[model samples]
Target: MDTSAIEALPWCADLSLNSANIWTVQQGRCAIGVVLLVEKSASVALIRKARVEGYEFSDRLALPGGLVRGVCGPSFAPCFEQSIRARAEEEAGLTAEQLSELAIAAPEFAPVSRYTVKCVERFAAVFTVRANIKRPQKLISADKSIQEAFFSPLPPKWEELAPANRLILARAMRDHAGDNVKTAARASVNEALAFCNDAAATVNVPPVPDPWMSPEA
Candidate 1:
């Protein structure tokens, strides 16, 4: 199992959803997540998932997303920005116009980071987008399934997040840390990832399938 995180996944843009949330491409399940980070204060806008039964990452801090849902033809070229914008609007109380205004070009988002959570059998791609929000703390969840939406300090206590998200946040916050702190944080994340990979190797747990699907909101 390859535990190293990469900037892009081969199937990241190959997945898509119809209005009904079924996989339009039938390529299998993979999730895409966004890290809406406020640059000035080093905070990230995250939604707290509602305490729902049978839901992974229940009541945990996570990105604004569920399954990939959008209109796409056989080509399946819906960009990551589509889902990122959709989730930001639906769950984080942002409007399409607002998010659209934030984007200037193709790579409005930060580097992509792909990961897998062995315990949940989840494969996901998480992208970080820098934002400039004056009152980030006032943000609220627009979706009922989410408990609340607020700006969490980057690298928020890892215990408060789900497994894959822990690595995502770690990578995002590492950029804001001092050189010494950055090195330490990176080492910590690599060790954690190594541990997960070794455990998966022993258990023969399928790490990441050829394709991926569904994320949390």
Candidate 2:
């Protein structure tokens, strides 16, 4: 992972409460979910690649996702739906139509740690699709950040993923297993959008400084 490149992205600005606390809040990255839309009968998207930096897990599996800007919008469903489609296409070479046919699976609020950063609170939206099309012959990281993409069975090995991603995958799997995939996915998306609208309504909310923490010390 290129720390500099990640930091330079425009979205990085939102990671911090203020400029002075960037590193401390790196884990507070952003929320973006990519559920591998799979047919009800088929339940996994598996891949192989090198773990983090030096470690290697030739047959590793994970859903596609990452931090996103413009996602905290008027509605979380559309934003999440759009982001998921975009990331899948961009990262795994999957298309939107290919995503919609399968059962939409998503993650409820869960905590995950990326690198040393911890997303203290997070949520995701998942969708499923069935494709007779062959999986990519060779997984290629479109963004260079991703290693590969493929499909496998659900309840993937949690210990295999980065801490943050592990939390996400675990929650998604748990939801899928609980028979709450559809309802939870919809609820999460709706809640996200509603939260966004409420927050937007308070755009003019007074910025009262905490007595212990001054804006200008």
TM-score of each: 0.60, 0.44
Q: Ten residues in a row with the worst lDDT in model 2?
A: 204-213
Cα lDDT tens digits for candidate 1, 21-95: 533221434444445544336567778888877666679777665443443433323544465566777788765
Q: What is the C-alpha lDDT profile of model 2 across 4-118, one tens digit per residue?
A: 3323434333333223221222344333334443323344554434445433322345565544334435433344456555666766677655444333322222232212224
Prediction 2 TM-score vs. true: 0.44
- What lDDT does candidate 1 reach at residue 44? 70
Candidate 2 residue spans exceeding 4 A from truth: 1-43, 47-61, 71-76, 101-107, 116-141, 167-217
The per-model lDDT (C-alpha) reads 0.49, 0.39
